[model samples]
Target: MNLKILTLDEFSRIDFINLVNKVFEDYTVPIKWDVVSFQLDVKENSISLSDSFVFLKDNIPFGFIVVSIRKEKARIDAMGVIKEERGTGAASYILEHTVNYLKWRGIRKIQLEVVKDDIRAYKFYEKHGFREKRLLYSMILKKTINQEINYRYFPVEPRTAYIQALEIYFNGRKPNWQREPISLLLSDNRYNFTKIVTNSGEGYLVWGKLEKENVPIIDIVAKNNYTDILKASINFLKSQTNCKNILISSVPEDDYLYQPLKKVSFQSILTQSEMEKEIF
Candidate 1:
């Protein structure tokens, strides 16, 4: 079979979406891919179609890998091969080519996150020079508004500088490439920030709705007494938005906010392994 590779821009948006969905058809996690989510991801993470690869066999897309390049770092946003194309070396071929492409572009590091339970993918990345770095938890809080829960927080429209300041302490709380301050600031979507003050001092929460899931994704940075702050923030969300759930994704090992989040009824729904490779 003849193998060829092309970038995302080479295909129409609809075709690209279809190919990705097909490739991920039987994925471990059910991903509902669509145009809006795709556009948002690209916009928020500075993903250029030129750096994202689509592999074809005899002119039919059979595999693909998406890379988001920053100044000196690149992130593997997603990678997959069509079921029939698996075991035919298409994945290895695409990965080898993509790594070389990034290195030639002067990228100093590459990173990605894989589901913790996906042993096949973990082994694949390990075999391919990626080293496991940290454990991350995906936490979810299902909406169960208590009649007694109080909402006394005010919303604050965040400036980049303010967000950065809040992140100084919890900056690495989330995954580096996808959920960090850099990515959040670049997001075209608006964020909702809430500030609450208690006897212990002041605390704040940063959150917004997931465009596709329509659930809130939250990040908290606050004083030592953060439990009350978290509760108030959730109450505010229930009061203002129709969000029925909240997602706190990819919280890293030793994330200070994890325990506080748990105290506020956030439960761990999934786990992930953060992997990275240093490129010369």
Candidate 2:
């Protein structure tokens, strides 16, 4: 059984996509990515093909790891091996190699998220020196908000929203990788931005305009009056779209939006543990 590990760029885009779908076919949340979605993930997540790795067994793609780099920090955006290769030590080899490479490239830290209930995954990372940093939640709001919004909200440019988000993040707000400022900047054109100013404080909302029943609330930051800001934002989104539900993904439990999301009737559907390992 000959095994080889190569950078993701060594494979064609289609081959990489196929390997990803195959490796994650039975994941807790199975992901099927077409070319468009795959490309978008690469772009928005800062996935570096040259830094990522794909594992091959006898010339066949058997597993893969997607890495996203930002200066001295990196994230394991996704990683999985096929069921057949699970216990063959291939995962350990891939992770060790990837960590060494990141250290060699001067990366100081690496982070990833796993489903909170996935014991095997949690133990695997824990054994490999990764520790839980925080809890993240995927929330959804299905029921329509029937209350009136007293505060006024106005549409703004993506740049404006990003500036506010960055300030909030720098000022003690902890955002997950997906909701980081860079992620927002990379996918700016895909979302609509709005800001609300009231006597209490100010806030901004970033949401996607999709032609589906589920609309994504990408980022929401407020200096004060969080509950009211969230309510007004939801009311505004409801008025602007015909969506059936509002979805918010990977919100850190310690973030300012967490309690407000709960206060506004958003229910946590899935929870993930954000794990980190220092490579230095």
Candidate 3:
């Protein structure tokens, strides 16, 4: 089958276009164009392309995987194969090769975040000897105009106080953490972080829209509740004269945000477990 792995830059115009289109159609993900562009940006400068892999048949791309190097670990980000080529052992082969490649590169561990409800993908990871690490408690709090908090931005503003609270939120909330935002901050395409200041406090919303998917995901957000600053922001989004889907993703285990979403009747979506394998 002449199995091979390809990096973003190494991919020809045709192959890149093919993989992205497949991802959208098969995975039901939106905005393949944006992903493709962002892939090039990070793949070219930050991530080492040679570190990624592509499966091929003769010179045709049958399957591909995008691996990322973060800190001392490597993660599998985007992976997909041509529909016709699936079940031809392409997926297993690519994963096996990736493990070996990372081991040879002197790495000991690899991890990736998979979406909840993707049973097949999760099973594949299990078969490959990966173990679930953590689950996030994701929640969505809908915005209601009935409750709005007034706010100002600094000094006397509760919004300023909210940001101040966040400064300490991480310290007390994540005592053992070295940094926050984890791989989500490097670029706009990676995450949509916006600063919202209310009269009583301020916070940030890590949410954005995907090009292919009409839904705008509200990932992880931190806001102050002093005078209902959180509600105001939610109201703002709910009031948005824009077309968007207010969804949360990758909920981790024991998330404080879970309670609020449940109270507001926001449905609880399944959770994804971050899985890892020791390659070294």
- Give the candidate order by descending lDDT: 2, 1, 3
List, residue by residue over 23-127, the lDDT tens digit for candidate 2. 787899777887888878888889999999888888988778899999999999988888888898878888998999999999999999999999999999999
lDDT of 3 at 210: 41
lDDT of 3 by residue, 42-87 (tens): 5322455678766668887777776777556777766777888778
lDDT of 1 at 186: 65
Pairs clashing in candidate 1?
none
> Which structure among the candidates has the greatest lDDT?
2
The reply for model 3, stretches above 4 Å from the true place, is 1-3, 28-31, 34-37, 40-48, 136-145, 153-185, 188-194, 197-201, 209-227, 239-245
Name the weakest run of 10 consecutive residues (lDDT summed) in model 1: 160-169
Q: Residue 254 in model 1: shift from native, Å? A: 2.6
lDDT (tens digit, per residue) of candidate 1 on 63-127? 88889988998889889888887887878888889999999999999998999899988998899
Query: What's the lDDT for residue 192 in model 2?
Result: 79
For every model shown, the clashing-pair count is 0, 0, 27
Stretches > 4 Å off in candidate 2: none
Query: Residue 122 in model 3: shift from native, Å?
Result: 1.8
After TM-score superposition, the amount by which residue 60's alpha carbon in candidate 3 deviates from its true location, in angstroms, is 1.0
